[model samples]
Target: MTTTDLLNVRSLSFAYERRRIVDLWSERFDAGLVWLRGPNGVGKSTRLKLLAGALAPQYGSATLNGKVDLLTDPLAWRREVAWVSAEPPPFEHLSPAELFGFLAGLYPRADRARWELHIEGFGLAPFLRQPLRQLSTGTQHKAALAAALALGTTVLLLDEPLNALDEASLVHWRACMAQAAASPDRLMLVVSHEELGVTPTRELILKP
Candidate 1:
């Protein structure tokens, strides 16, 4: 693995009842935008989950920053990585402001003003005071994206990031992703079948 690589997966494999889901054996990943593309049920999201330390690999191992085992230090590992999925978190009776506030507390140095700026940038300002459950799907997705960015983690794992976004919103998201990928210290991994406007530094195509 390169000294600058933030994540490394060696001989990594996982399966469900003898069916291999992810067989991405021996791959060294560095800091940049990596697009993991494959058809449905091909383990695209599963691989991202493993990288984010949200799921344990059935075989081989995953190492972060050369020393830390993601499974052993999930909390510490999560501090360095952020995962965003198509489905926004369930917010039943909680308002957007309340939900953002709760998530911000997880990061000791999270700036509330900065988070608000993102919300506004995403055109979520109008719904800030409304309950998250009542917001439209696109609005909810926007909120989730803002919350994930606010964490300021080094690694970002996004699954179907453009799910509910309109054409204009998709263009804006692509630009935002490009800007974020400009930082050499930060790595963004996207798992999507759709054509994202942003270009990836690396592309990993999964095969059955």
Candidate 2:
């Protein structure tokens, strides 16, 4: 991946309850798997959320391809970004199948075929009929991941992705990540305690 397809952040700062979480951080990440390595409470997930446009940073400017600015062109910027949270879905009624259908209608570039494949690849086909509350934590994460991966976005923010994956599902994800790492224009920031397999283009270690 080249610097032309970079995920660049400058003057990055964030605070919670008047306590500084991210303080004047600045980094340029080239397109590839970026291992977001840090100790717990270091704001790794918060940084991802900031980039995903879920949480606005107290200070900073971010750009994709040096063209799409997060602050100025947020709608266009969000089209190229996808976030996969480690936490299970908060809602209780919707199933993975229902979630996929809803997302397919929601996103303009939704890939229904890819979602079908992911459902089987993640071993979630059998649980498609089950409600979110009926599924296990791992299964819920799988559903969220499947939706995110199929969105065909350039920026993928994966928080603790390898957690709760079974042996076969883990293998599937490893292969998928390896393929993603080889992409020339895609950026993946994986927040994890363990390095699953693929090599990271860079390690972003955050300090509180």
How well does each candidate superpose onto the true structure, as a TM-score? 0.89, 0.92
What tens digits encode model 2's per-residue C-alpha lDDT throughout 29-143? 8878888887899889888888889888888879998899998999888888888877786455889988877766656687989988888899998899899898888899999
lDDT of each: 0.77, 0.84
Expressed as tens digits, the lDDT of each residue in 1-208 for candidate 1 is: 5364578778777787888887856777787788888777878887887777767788777677676667677777777787887567656477778877887777665667878777767888888888878989888888888787777777888999988887766766887778766767778888888887888888889876
Please report how far candidate 1 places residue 136 from its true position, in Å. 0.9
Candidate 1 Cα errors over 4 Å, as ranges: none
Q: What C-alpha root-mean-square deviation, in Å, does candidate 1 show against the real structure?
A: 2.1
lDDT of 2 at 68: 95
Candidate 2: minimum summed lDDT over ten consecutive residues — where?
Answer: 1-10
Error of 1 at 134 (Å): 0.8
